[model samples]
Target chain A: MNVIVEAGANYVGVIGAGEGATGEQMVQARRVGELLARKGVRVVTGGLGGVMRAACEGAVGAGGVTLGLLPGSDRADGNQFLTVSVPTGLGEMRNALVVRSSEAIIAVGGSWGTLSEIALAVRTGVPVIALGGWPLPGVEVLVAQSPEEAVEAAVRTLAR
Target chain B: MNVIVEAGANYVGVIGAGEGATGEQMVQARRVGELLARKGVRVVTGGLGGVMRAACEGAVGAGGVTLGLLPGSDRADGNQFLTVSVPTGLGEMRNALVVRSSEAIIAVGGSWGTLSEIALAVRTGVPVIALGGWPLPGVEVLVAQSPEEAVEAAVRTLAR
Candidate 1:
């Protein structure tokens, strides 16, 4: 068990819709954040509204650190739950960084932006566990039934 | 015509693929850059390769100022044609800024990244001229057969 314990910093990105998240999506995303936080995993996100904020809040609630990669130039654009705010004024182009930076990803229902992240992640060989997220062709992403399952898959993927 | 060319900074975004652009794509993008430069329009781009580099080179060839919004943190990642390179470190999300900052957009052949920019620009009501680029759904973007026509459309849109 001691041998399996990783030594370096591990970042888990929780990706989903920035705005207009459904009630169920927000709940599941927040729960995923909480579960990952409880296991001492650092949660990463785009840090705006909807699912990003929910995940960050969940991480914060569980005493876990959250990193917010904001699209705007202003740091204030980040959510209140972020422990660190990287205001990357790159707008939507920052999605590549978000997908690339994460060791593993937990994706809930998302938009075209989220679809793009999934594509980028798959292309770069980043493991993604989708919880009702966009379905892409020619990409092999694991589908989770619930938040608990998503977090479980994430942990298993990263532990290896 | 001289009166119409008022003294102001006209920022035009030249967006397209990083690589895999056809020779025709490069030629048209270059001509667009040249035309914009002749009309005193400041060209903006992602500043790496393909259509962006070609556009910037044309702008420089015609003595026009070009700005590159780089995705990486390294200033050296940007191409040489840019008069000013803004290292955004935001990766692909910089597309939004590239679109929003420009008064009008000229899109050459592109992949997923360029497709995202076109979608974003249309969402924000920024005029776009697609010079043999992808055809997006529900977006009213102008399709031009040549670089001259693309530049003409952009100039007309911005002037209005």
Candidate 2:
């Protein structure tokens, strides 16, 4: 089966904790999504809950396009805020799709899953802007103090 | 798009270094694939060179079905030994797919990519049987001294 890669549109992944994300992380992720959408960048996410749901909500609320790469085979498993959802059935492996579909990544919070994505992105030369995540010593992860800063870093890196 | 998860095919992932794998690791990986295929189990891999290619070669030589989930968008990126190849276009992030698609994993050797798969499997409750991989102090990875032992451990775990 052939999977088409969307052309011309800038895609950015917003990755973070799924179920147990803190309230502050959700808020930050939502803001990051909103800002990215306003910039005409497509917001790509894991498409389940917590930060993923919040990011889609914020982007959709702003009348922007959001793509959810779901872990299950059912599209209904995605959050309500997604503009388009694809059930990848890759489970946590879908995390790679999320990272690959984007030119840059803005990590909202820390989780084992998130760490895996970050590691993958770094390994594959995708720039990452961590808003609030665990420190990786000897790894070059761009740190962002706020959502705005994260968005700015991501966009700037994409520009380069 | 709906991805059909092949039913009734017992899949086990053979993961390790891609381009820079050692000769010994390639030999071990091939033996593991041959053994698994002889047991009527399907072998899954990342569909590139090094350990992945050797494993596929052994499986196909043994007349076993081998599936390669490629990192690129083109099926040509897969090795010749693959009976079927799916171009996932997920890049290094496709490591998650490799882990998620398998009932158990037999790591022929270790790399950052291999480590990511192992981490994903451990987090998601998939069993792992490591052959000459790194030490994970807290993770529950079964150790195998040879490819025969590794395949035995993998099939035994799947049985349970």
Candidate 3:
């Protein structure tokens, strides 16, 4: 079967923890999504819970499109915030999808899962801006203190 | 797109590094694949190069079914060793698929990527057998010295 892949330059990855996200971190992720959406960016996320849910909520709340790349085979499993859900059945490997499909990555508080996406983004030369995410040595991950800064950096990176 | 998802018990995850696998490690992976296949277990992997390729080769060589859950959107990106390639388009997140789909996990020498799968498997109550793989602090990962031992232990774990 042919699965229609999401293709475009307007997509941006908001990488973060799939679970156990702090309430503050979720708020920041949501704001980041809102800011990105205001710029006409289509937010891409892991499509599970915590930060993913919050980000998608904020983006959709701001009347912007969002895509959820679910790890399971059922689209119904995606968060209520997503405008489109693609049940990839790819599991955590979908982290690579979030990185590869986005023009740039705006990272929030994350763990092992978010770190994987950051690594993949760096490997593929996709610009990554960490708002409050794990920092790796020897990799150039731009740091932003707030959601607005993160979106601005992503926009500037894409412009270049 | 009615994408066919590979589900159920015959599936087994062979976890390892995406690259930088030692020649000996690859051999062990291949042998483990062969043994599992002979026992009618369908081998599952990330579907990239190195150990993944070797394992798929050994499984298919023994006339056993093998599935490659690829990180990209193109099936052509999979190694030639697999019997079927499902382009998961999920990147490293695909590790979750391997953990959730398999009845048991046979972990070879791996890096951070395989470590994630191990964590997932342990949490999901899927049995795991480690062959020179990283050990977790609190998880019960059975150790094996050889590919044969690893496969045997994995099968036993599933049986129980």
Which predicted model would earn the best lDDT?
Answer: 2
User: What value does the lDDT take at residue B44 in candidate 1?
Assistant: 95
For model 3, the stretches where C-alpha displacement exceeds 4 angstroms are A1-9, A17-19, A38-40, A46-49, A57-65, A68-100, A111-149, B1-9, B17-19, B34-40, B46-49, B57-101, B111-153
For residues B1-160, what per-residue lDDT tens digits would candidate 2 score against the true structure?
5222446769999998888899999999899889988988899999999999999989988878898999899998899999889998866767777887899999887766776787688879889899997665444789999999999989987853
Q: Per-residue alpha-carbon lDDT of model 3 for A73-133, expressed as tens digits?
A: 9988899999898898866656667776788998898565676576567756789898886
- Report the candidate with higher TM-score, 2 versus 3: 2
lDDT of 3 by residue, B42-149 (tens): 899889888888889899899888889897999999999888888987666566677767899888895656755775676567888889864444437788999998
Residue A129 local lDDT, model 2: 92
Off by over 4 Å in 1: A1-7, A57-64, A69-101, A112-160, B1-6, B60-64, B69-101, B115-129, B133-149
What is candidate 2's lDDT per residue for A40-139, written digit by digit as tens?
Answer: 7889999989999888888887767899999899999999998889999877778878888889999998876786787778777889899987665334
What are the DockQ scores of the candidates, in order? Answer: 0.17, 0.26, 0.12
Q: Return whichever of 2 and 3 wins on lDDT.
A: 2
Question: Model 2: runs farther than 4 Å from truth?
Answer: A1-9, A34-40, A58-65, A71-77, A83-96, A134-140, A143-149, B1-10, B34-41, B57-101, B119-124, B132-149
* Pairs of colliding residues, candidate 1: A90-B93, A90-B94, A91-B93, A92-B93, A93-B92, A93-B93, A93-B94, A94-B93
Chain A TM-scores, per candidate, are 0.92, 0.93, 0.91
Cα error, residue B47 of model 3, in Å, equals 5.4
